[model samples]
Target: MDLDLAQVRAFVLAAEESHFGRAAEALSISQQALSKRIARLEAGLGTALFRRTGHGVEPTGAGDRFLEPARRALAAADRAVAAALDERRPPRVDVWGHLYAPMRTLAQVAAGSGAPPLELGHGRDLPSVAAALLRGDIDAAFGRVHPPLPAGLTHRLVRLEPVDAVLSADHPLADEPALRPGQLRDSVLWTPAALHRLDFLHRFAERFGIRHHAEGTNLGLDGFLADVAADPRRFSLMPADVPLPDDPGIRSVPLVEPTPLYAWSLLWCGGNPRVDALLGALAAEAGRSRWLEYDPAEDWLPEPAGEPA
Candidate 1:
């Protein structure tokens, strides 16, 4: 028998909440509508699924038996929708955080190498990019990653970048040649939530007692720097490789102390012959480049998990 997914989801929620009012609120529907949906579902299955109690509603014996299966069905429906959406999208490589390095690699590869040209675009932060790669929303991406990737992904080392700070041009420290990690003990720093939430950022800030404001601010990159320029009380860190905007009001300063390096990687899904060739060519180029410091001899590089469908 064909089952209605919405009704099944409603049934599961009502059973779990054990109160029609609470269940409807959770589902963002009225209690009367929730009652009707449950009633329709119960009638379809020829059972009395709930009993009105003094305090609320209690699931019947049959309702208890059906709840687990209903939840499973709802989950299966969600997966089906996601899969269908992925299939409809075109293939592209997504840049999770910074686009400069990865774009440079791909551009060089497209120029001299016989590898297929790649279309690149911006993807979200770490975990979100991870999800999109697995879901087939993008064929590959570049971002900072440490250690083993997800079950269906692999990474190639790009470069290890030094920690640097961004400060307003008018700030007292802007004219300094370089920065040390501990010089900001009583200072205020601002970084987007995504960047500052990294374990490395948290640990480094805590050691020096640096007060950080991680607002994931609405101000775009230029606006963010402009705000920093207006307020000498703020500062933020970046990897030496991260491209800095040429705003006269702001400056990029390298943090000479070398503990928390930004490890960038080229992340990809498995088994596209063209993409695999492209990755091989790109890796070869990186190994030869002076700035990248890649080593083809390193046994640490992991292969793609398995062929992408």
Candidate 2:
């Protein structure tokens, strides 16, 4: 026999309310419709389920016996529907650039807290990265956002680190405390051939109206440094985090004017659960750090459990 949840619900309500009219009203259905559903239910089980009395209604022996199981089955059906609705919103996996450091720390925290390790993806440039995000190709992205990012994407600046200008010791600007974008004009500039190059050079050039030359066809770190030292006039820029070369002939000066600071941010589409989770984790880490240094007494008030304190 195939039992229906609607029939089970009707039977429970009728049994609980003990009145066909009140049960149907509680269920927001016509009493005749409720009676028909109950009749169908009883027919499926091959038993008479209720006796209609003048005062109200009484459950037959078969109906009384089936009551508990019927209620359980209806509850299970409701839970199944709820679960289906919840599954309509699935969590997403995160994707980040190779240079993302703080998120790597957060990923470690999530792992320690039993979250699965993050997944990563790569693209040649920021526009390409932003495109992938717009197309739903990745759940979240991590990298620098020099200006306000693309309109739809949201970001949180997690960390900032200094980048230094690399030069041969004899280079004219090597000793300068900071560099203005204009000073590098007519100089051979070297940078990674990756997206970061375009982000720093092209964008900076456009923003500050500086003319510069890109060194070599493809000058990577090793080649750029080699080129810089070989030709004392040529200089390359890299993050200050790079270990200083043993060659006292080379020096790294922290650049000022356009402030050579690199920003690391977590970004995602405006509304997404995976991104939300990632942000929440990041915020928790920040809060933990902040609470340690400057504790806020008002924020940690004791909760009232049994009696008010």
Candidate 3:
């Protein structure tokens, strides 16, 4: 019997999720489309693969028998594609949150001797990156991984970066050795985009009772930081390792007492050898730098999604 790989993939995801809606979501297709694919697949096999239940779906005896082989077929297809592309080519990687400089971590990884070459690109956010990963437009991406991640993609926490408050040099709290989240409750939480689009900053503001918020045009990091420096009332959070533009007008104050950590994770579709190499190199670098270190007693993290707390 001839079986379409797309149909096979849809069946596998549906079986894994046990819910057609979620399976469709993971495939980035409509529920109706997913159902049709599976229906066609079942017709080709001449048997029902699934049975509807109150919770979602359960595999029929045939489906239970087919599951492992379907997974192998998908993996083999991925390998064929990877082989055709040529393993010598660097893995194509994209990153989100460019405004915060995700490249710094990648650059650090690349700097290590014997690290594999990488072709880097930029993505707007997690959703966009997830789409690119699904489409095979890119092999992997780096950014903050949050919930509802597309089903086929997988991620691993790479770094936990402590954040600092960016303040104008003349701000009242500027000269303090360090500031706690509570210390900035009265200041405006400056952001480059609307709070809803800036998950990390929004959560930080909500967690700390920083009520005032201001949005500015994002010309780039330099322009954004310059705007932050222009007003003493404006403050923003940034990963401590991100280098500030040389301007005496602004200062980067470490957030202490309960420091907020920005979780960085490497996300990818499985079965890429290059991605495996990159992961290993990143792991070695993280170990050397203690990049994943976290002291829960003294640090604060957003509630765990897929990312490490």
Candidate 4:
């Protein structure tokens, strides 16, 4: 049956006070109005809820029975409203990346003017991470992107790094100030090719005339260093900002003369918070670092037949 919450509240307060005047004062309504609300509630339930006495009033058996359930209903209503409001509150946007040097740089850039709250998701590579971003499971991801970025999903160039070589310690050119491209022609570059979709890495190997060994992703860092130390003819390319292993068996040197860049970007689907604003801040912040940057307008993807313009 239809029942007013106000009537229920008036009944409860009046029953508790046992005095119509005191209950009215507590409810900020006139004595007549309080009496009328309680009367209406009692009539709806077809029972006498209170009996007038010299002390003012007292609950009937029916009123006492109704009091506990009425209080519970009001408490339930309060909880329902609070839960509804909580559902309407804004969502927390997330920023995700591996904890590499470039990712650290991205964190600084993204914290612009202390804006939209960020949840940092970490230690994942691009393929799985990109899938999550596209599925709206994550807000944004930071990593090097492969070609054919899906429609409606775009990238902002955040950090750019030159390719550095991990060379055998005994290699003749390892002592040079930096490596020139001409010396790279006869070398073979080995990579964790099976672990990622790095089209750019393969293309860079082709453009620089270096043979590439598409090794399986089973090697650990120590194992990789051992492989490098074991061969004078094999070298590996890594992002310049990424830390190299400290080993006397190898030398880490930047590649020069049309230096290949490893570009990282923020990839997102439509309508995300702080993406454009954060990208702008990143551009300004990166200028202070040694890494070169692409214009914010240029998509992170490479230009065909050449470097990003």
Best candidate, lDDT: 3
lDDT of all predictions: 0.64, 0.61, 0.86, 0.64
**Model 3, span 248-295: residue lDDT tens:** 999999999899999889998766666888888888998899988888
TM for candidate 2 is: 0.49
Query: Which runs in model 1 stand beyond 4 Å of their true positions?
Result: 1-91, 98-112, 146-149, 194-200, 207-209, 214-218, 241-243, 291-309
What's each prediction's clash count? Answer: 1, 0, 0, 0
lDDT of 2: 0.61
Which of 2 and 3 is ahead in lDDT? 3
Residue 245 shift from truth in candidate 1, angstroms: 4.0
The reply for model 4, stretches above 4 Å from the true place, is 1-102, 107-117, 122-127, 212-223, 274-277, 290-309
What's the alpha carbon RMSD for model 2? 20.2
Candidate 1 per-residue lDDT, tens place, 251-286, comes to: 888765532455557776554332565566665665
Once model 1 is optimally superposed onto the true structure by TM-score, how far is the C-alpha of residue 230 displaced, in angstroms? 1.8
Q: Candidate 1, residue 264: CA error in Å? A: 1.4
Give me the displacement of residue 101 in model 2, in angstroms. Answer: 8.2
* Model 2 stretches astray by more than 4 angstroms: 1-116, 146-152, 175-186, 194-197, 206-210, 217-220, 244-249, 281-309
Displacement of residue 158 (Cα, Å) in model 3 is 0.8
